[model samples]
Target: MAMFVHVTSAANAPRIRRSGIRAVSHGQGDARGVYCFPVLPSYTLTHQWLRELARFGSRGGLVAVHVRLDDDEEVLLGRYADRARNAQATVPAAQAVRRIAELDDPRGWEVFVPRAIRPRELHRIRTAPQVAGWRYRPDAHGTRPCTCFGCRVRGGYGARRLRERLPHPLDGPPPPVRVLLARVAAAGEPGDPVVLREVLHWFGMRRRGPLDRLAHLAAHPDPGVRKDLVWAVAGWSTPGVGDLLDALADDPRDEVREAVEAVREPE
Candidate 1:
């Protein structure tokens, strides 16, 4: 009963079925489009199909297409959403990577995921309870470079230079290097300090430029943050940095005061 505006191939129909989508006859078209019954796959299967759809959609192909899911499909998406939130197994994470690779089309992969799952999933897999604590699969290491901002910033030219650069996870997160630093510096005054501190620390474990930004952050409002910034900057020791430290020589906070003294001390 539910029909596509365009005639679909029998092959495409099966593909949809295999994809955990069931076509339900809802007496015909609905106001939204076509209403089909949902095919509920295990959470793993749902994750797989979503990744596949995203990857496939990203490929420059076809046109703007709307996929109308039946009531069942909507319910399944919610179920998987819940499963994803509560997932305690690396199996789900590994499945995520496998499903993405299966898509073959990076553009399409971007099109289907939750934005977070596409790029960050690898990281999550690496650190999560299931994958991180248990095993390391060199195969699952994502030969493709992560397209997320964090990966680009941390990986630098190395990630770009690599032959395979995967699309970002659902088009967001792992923010770009410049964007991350700018937001960090702007935090609290016109932004949020917690977000700034979190990102700064995240950068600390990754690359170098973030430290340079930190040095200039001595003027930050939070004394503790300023102290951390000073420590990060001291690693680089640029010209006139000594003078900058000298200016803060009398800071009341012991940490800031010590940083200023250490930075200004004769070599």
Candidate 2:
């Protein structure tokens, strides 16, 4: 959420008193810091003005005046349509999603994404300044996960861990585990043995992977890694390569038994 500061009552008074307009600062820690733009008869007018203020296009007035959607508007108009529909709201107070019908009907918002945006896809609307940060782009810092299971295992750990365990090239100081984890997150399969094993090891670095896969590896080769991996793989209990896991479960290896016992505690 964005915060608007240095706001005066005059510029915002019209919309503030109309339509019971509200501004929510999503990033602000304190609720008291949230500014409520009261609704007025001139709500549409104030809304235009607030939009200008948010865009820094307002002429010489109300610098940094924050404007945000009320709880219902955010939930309804801001992509939480399912939640809004599920919520029982009065007609006037409910989200005016029906108004959006006008958008799809001939001439509307006209802003279509290059790809189909699913209902579950999160839509983040950012201003020019916010979008200027290329750091937020995917693969900007090479954080993209490797799709291959071997690559995922190697990528999830730093170059050092990977060098010790696997047959992959190790460049200088290892890339941060975050970059590797992101790669794994994007490409690592839920049930692949190498991906699952690497994910388990990576959790010790405080990175969690797909849970059920980790649970399947509860009887993995390494004991300590399994302990932390279990937490990451919580709520997923699907059986995996049972023969492999069962073998690890019955293995004479002390490390293997310890890890399996830790994960199978509640089961």
Candidate 3:
């Protein structure tokens, strides 16, 4: 089935293209196929757009809505006519894309969408300068352990072990650095959030030789990877870093441009 993705920010375009979906203009009239919307807080659904989507649904077009409320909660909605189906799961974006790819028809929409629920609002304290940093304080009495598979795996010794295994900048190239760089080289699959996050974390840790080797990932096919790479290279003072930031400044994704602006020093 042909899929059409309607997005507000250029950042979402690369992901849609990688998914083999066509990008449709907001005012396009021929979007009568599978409609996909990536809901973000900054964009509001206009009345005309809503009416058009409803009309598309009434005409038997399928609608897919993906919402990421926080790190812990995500909701996917599917609507046809007045009937709606949704699914709430802690699956990463990559897994969600795979689930959507499995559906062959409208009848299988619910398989990708589940029933939705109201998400709890999250609040964080912003440090001075707004860009300086953030302080997150969870409710001590109400806090509970996350039981999602990814959380469980992260809670294990993996993160700790990885941190411990990272090579010291003064030690020159180390075994862990080689291994991490190898993973960075093989991170070509679309929507593989886990691998990309790990690679980004490793690159963010030290600004030594290994990080320089990963400058190529700045143009990774996955926007998520590029976003993380921008953050990882933000603090570097290398000449290549400046050129990389300049190239990414014109990126279609506003998120990438914002990241570039964040690290860019005033002239």
Q: What is the TM-score of each candidate against the true structure?
A: 0.29, 0.24, 0.33
- What value of lDDT does candidate 1 attain over all alpha carbons? 0.38
RMSD of each: 18.6, 18.2, 20.7
lDDT of 3: 0.44
lDDT string for model 3 (81-180, tens) is 2132222343543444445455443221211222221122111111111111111111222554343323333334344554345433332222366787
Task: State candidate 1's TM-score.
Answer: 0.29
Note the residue pairs that clash in candidate 3.
11-253, 86-113, 86-114, 86-115, 87-113, 87-114
lDDT of each: 0.38, 0.35, 0.44
Model 3 alpha-carbon drift over 4 Å, by segment: 1-175, 188-193, 265-267
lDDT for position 86 in model 3: 20
- Whichever of 1 and 3 has more TM-score, that candidate is 3
User: Per-residue lDDT for 1-267 in model 2, tens only?
Assistant: 211122333454444434322444333222212322222233232232233233333333342233433224332222222322434222221233333333332111111111211222222221222121122122235564333333343433254554545433322223355664564566434444556445444444332333343344455444554444543443234344343344456656676556556656785
Q: Which model, 2 or 3, shows the larger lDDT?
A: 3
Off by over 4 Å in 1: 1-176, 185-191, 202-216, 261-267
Error of 2 at 4 (Å): 8.3
The full ranking of all candidates by TM-score, starting with the best, is 3, 1, 2
Q: Model 2 scores what on Cα lDDT?
A: 0.35
